[model samples]
Target chain A: MWEQIRSNQTRTLVLVVAMGLLLLLVGYFLGEAIFGSGIGGLVVAILIWVVMNLFAYFQGDSMILAISRARKISPDDHPRLYNVVEEMKIASGLPKIPDIYIIDDPSPNAFAVGRDPSRASVAITSGLLERLNRDELQGVMAHEISHIKNRDVLLMTFCSVLLGTIVILAWFGSRMMLFGGARGGRRSSGGGGGYATLIIVAVAILLMILAPIAAQLIYYAISRKREYLADASGALYTRYPEGLASALEKIAGSTQELKTANQAFAPMYIINPFRSKGRAASDLTSTHPPISERVRILRSMAGGASLAAYEKAYQEVRGSGRGVIPPSALVGETPVAARKAEAVPAEPGKVERARETSDLLWKYSNYGLVNCECGTKLRVPPKLRGSSIRCPHCGRVNPLSSRP
Target chain B: MDCPACKGVVVVVEYQRIELDYCTKCYGVWFDAGELSLLAERLDLRGAALDVNQIAALPEKKAAEKARGCPICRKKMKKVTLGSAPEVLVDVCTRGDGLWFDGGEVGQVLGQLKDKGAAADEQGRVIDFLGEVFHVRG
Candidate 1:
């Protein structure tokens, strides 16, 4: 598994280099067909892409955060969450503490964004804070921190910028073809022209049609591997895969679509924004693996299993009939291996139980109004005001007041 | 000076009262958030509510002010737009507490929310009707 992860990283690095060379080669050839292989024009386009993409990459964080209406938080405002990040940062050996931001969204999701660990930030929805308990929160935070520590954020952003450049270039090339590139072609063709113009136009069209999809595929492959890497690294940080496993369960339950998230930032989120499609279990086109597989892996890690055992278990679970579990409460001990096997030959009654438990857990985590005073937690509904309640442990009469 | 919605806490900065009633999750401003209350009291609620659908037409501009911590932001909220509709502007605490709606903006925002709720219901009904109508044809 270690060797696979290492090899994957090496492979992705090589692919990035190969992609750049391929793009340059194509650009050079196309430039020749139109401009008679003028190195100046080819060089100019490369320079422009480098300049524009660098500028976008540098400012991308602020732009994305502003669009989401996320607000920065100081450690004083959210101490527990701050502490969780601090712990993860220390464990991950990251030099600086990443800034924390919270989206005022009532959806359970979090994503890490930035060019690198030093510049990176993690944003979690208010729903995540309200839904997951301390340990689970740590699990989720650890996952994001893992992304940063592994430099996945930087790699992903670079991939996006490169992909965007390819798309823009393709679009421009297509526009030139339709509107007449022959006019421009004449200037550099040295009057040996018509055949060069036709070939250039045809090839330009071909590249334009194929580049974006190819870029997208490359981006997805990189992204999916990074997610797997992060999952593994996150487990190493928390040393309790169940924390993340349970967090995934809770998040998977809601299925409330994020209205604000668009495709550009959608891939960064823990779960897909289009959860309403009942696509939680399907990893059809997504770069990220299925949440069920992630949960299964995490659970196995939590249960103190070897990596080989986890791999075997994961493959077994995937082939079997059991689909992803919806949001369920963490009540008792459920080992990863056991869950994977149970998922394999899921009994009819157990499937019903999984659904029921998930529904219950979702409700308990979301709508329960728990107000703690003197460390005693009281869960009350909106209508239960003015009721005389006693603390379970302290024997003190705790009257419910709307003001509090 | 008193915030009308949650009535939890209020802070006075620059001789203006700022109230906090905003929930962290929903990020919806509550009535007690200062300028909103003043605006609501001065304006006609029914008229403001009727104009709710036009809330998106409001203008927003950053106001020049020195730092004075808002009870919500726990840091000074630079005077930001309070109402997006009927174009009322107010001070907002940076910390996401509550917004201070100027004059009639609060009532207008409430009115807009009501209109939105109604619009949503109307849309739902249309969809349901279409579904039923299409069901018979299919």
Candidate 2:
């Protein structure tokens, strides 16, 4: 396990340095076009990298939450969700119950973010909460909690930043080469070493075009491996692989787009938020291991929900242990008895369930929930006139504005 | 978000995975453009599918006259009937911001979709898995 962590650390460092060198090289060549020298571009590239890193280190989670329009929720506001989060926190032995956030989007998805467990936050789309029952929700939260415990969140944070910068630098370099290179190219061509200069320029341009893509591939590689580990760890923590496996089914089946999701950050999610159905994991552009493959592995686990069980299932499914779960990261656990069918209640009817779900959301948003005498319940928004509301059910006017 | 019908404070609501704004004062609900479709599709009702394309193709029963301003952008919203049953007349924002349903109207729309969607759930593999895993018998 220690070796696995060490290898991950080494790989992350190598990936970042490789990306940085790509940025520096592309900057140098594009710098040549703009300033007739690579020095200025190299300096700017370094500055951007430093500044972006500083920003990401300090404000990355906040920035991500803000962009996703995720809002913090009080425990009292959504006890059901808060309870689930607290359960995972205890099970994972995380120092603090990570802050919980809710994005308004109707897409079923969830993710965790922070440099470490103490500062971490878990954000789930409203859609996910409405879709998953309590145990399923527990499974999903467990996955994110495992991510926090494993420091995968921190690692991905670093990778995402590096990927962003490399892509930006390459884009800026191409634009500069196109508009600013005519004079520089002409002057270099007039020199005695014209052909050599031309070849250097060609190679620089080619590298600039490919650098961003190369950085993304590396980013995806690291991200994909971490996801499987989180799944395994999460199942171990919950002692219910069925919970997460079932949750994945619900998440994968949803077609709604998470309106606030940015494509680059899709890796942080439990499932690929933007992934279309049936996309193979072997696709270089995939941000997650295939959902079908993952679900199959989770279901295939026998014995207890130990890391060993997960590893064995992974080996059977993937045909090799390779990079799915890092070697030795799995700790043995006493597998609890399989939960009895009657131990968990069947879900309520759709209308009742929907009403309960709406009440949950409304309570968090400070909306008033009142049941009419005619049996119709109303969710009143905080901003509206809290006055007389006619029941669409019985056509009897209910006095709601009487409340101060 | 303000309620389109009663101009009262609106609260957010969710069902399945689809979220909409509901008014406290008038009990009206709002579904952003594409949200209704999203909600319907998420319900995954196979028999009586109420997709966006189906709703768009419905004959304009009510004209665009007296269009209400969009709650988000306040543009004049066009009125359109929902579903094949020609159910509630939803005031749709021309800018595609969302649709406005008077109090109880959302219930009507969802109730119908749910009926159709219910038949489809009989074969849902996920639900079957949940039943097996959780020990729910149907």
Using TM-score as the measure, which candidate wins?
2
Query: Mind giving the per-residue lDDT tens digits that candidate 1 earns over A1-404?
Result: 23233333456787677667656755655555545554754685587569766876788888878887777878766677799999999877778899988776545688888877788889887656656766678889988987887777777777777776776666666676567554446653566566756666667567668876777777766677677667665665676667788999988766445546766565677766655455545544576677877887666543543333344445455666432211121123232332222232532232232223222332333323333354434443343334554432244555555323
Query: Best candidate per DockQ, number?
Result: 2
Chain A TM-scores, per candidate, are 0.70, 0.89
lDDT of 2 by residue, A277-327 (tens): 566667878888888888998898864587767878888998874545544
Report per-candidate DockQ. Answer: 0.02, 0.14
Kindly report which residue pairs in candidate 1 clash with one another: A32-A37, B3-B32, B4-B32, B5-B32, B36-B101, B39-B103, B49-B111, B52-B112, B55-B85, B73-B95
Q: What tens-digit string does per-residue lDDT give for candidate 2 at B1-138?
A: 666666676654433344556565665667664455444444564443344333434465565434567787666666676534525676766544556766555545444543444333322322222112212100
TM-score of B-chain for each predicted structure, in order:
0.29, 0.60
Interface RMSD of each: 24.6, 13.5
